[model samples]
Target: MKEILVLYYSHRGSVRALAEQIAHGIHQVPGAVARVRTVPRVSTVCEAVADDIPAEGPPYVEERDLAECIGLALGSPTRFGNMAAPMKYFLDGLAGAWVNGTLVGKPACVFTSTASLHGGQESTLLSMMLPLMHHGMLIAGLPYTEPALNETRSGGTPYGASHVAGQEGSAALSADEIALAQAQGRLLAGYALKLAVAR
Candidate 1:
């Protein structure tokens, strides 16, 4: 099977939910599979350390995951109009991959969740794209052709799939949000298949 890595960081489960939906979409395409992974949270205190295995949810991603995956779906909750620190930290540590061009020519998509309607989802998505771009990956966004891009009132955008998780971060994924994420997964997987065939 061709695997697409769904890498994400979630504080309140909102971004994780979107990641699952995106994985579901990837599985819709024949010969495509989703490999869900999460990043460990960073501590401000200098002495803190994360366990090798997480207590719950997906385990932290490894370099092997990046090397093996055919495509990538990166997600994170918005942190003041940017990706959360843990996600950024993980990406920053990938200089070796960048130097080796491990991700070059691969397809990638970004997703995010925000605490409010204007919580900088687009900017967060843009920030996530920067690292992927540096890795020489092809960035994919939701096109107008997807009805959810025009119809979603909660959390879908041309930049990528997003969620309005409310002030307390209590919002659940709306139907439209789920559909759009799934659509993006399918689109990305299809593109990966074509790229594989081209080679």
Candidate 2:
């Protein structure tokens, strides 16, 4: 079976919600499975430490996950138009994966959630792609052919999957957002399976 990693960081549970939806879509593809993981949070206070295993949710991701996964679905809430600090911190630790080309030629996609409609959803998505590009992964975005991209009133983008959590973070993912996220996962999984077979 081919595994696709669904890695994310969520505050207020919005990004995690999107991650779960993306995993749902990955499982739809035959021979593809989702390996869900999360990163430990960062803190301003010096020497803040976390347990080896999280109190809940998936296990903390290791560099090995990148090499093992045929595809990757990365998610983080928008923080000033970029992925949140913890997610970026996790990516920064991937220099070993970069030097070794552990993720080279793998399929990857990004997703994000924002507190406002104008909050940096697209920019956040783009920012997340930078590190993956350095690793030589093929970036997949939601194509316009997906009906949600054309019709979504909330969160959906050509860059990747997204959600608008509103200022109070009250809004659940709209239907279109859900559809687009699932479609992006399906697209990534299909590509990974095909590429793995070719290799």
When summed lDDT is taken over every stretch of 10 residues in candidate 1, the lowest stretch is 43-52
Q: Residue 118 in model 2: shift from native, Å?
A: 0.9
Please give, for residues 1-199, the per-residue lDDT of candidate 1 as tens digits. Answer: 9999999999999999999999999999999999999998888662276578898898889998999998999999998899999999999999999999999999999999998988999999998999999999999999999998889999999999989998888748999999999999999999988887775
TM-score of each: 0.96, 0.96
lDDT at residue 170 of model 2 (Cα atoms): 59
**Best-fitting candidate, measured by lDDT?**
1
lDDT for each candidate structure: 0.92, 0.92
- Sequence-dependent TM-score of model 1: 0.96
Worst 10 residues of 2 by lDDT: 43-52
User: Where is model 2 more than 4 Å wrong at Cα?
Assistant: 44-47
- Model 2 lDDT per residue over 1-199, tens place: 8999999999898898899899999999999999999998888552266677998999999988888899999999999999999999999988899999899999999999999888999999999999999999999988899988999999999999999998788537899989998998899999999999887
Which pairs clash in the backbone of model 2? none
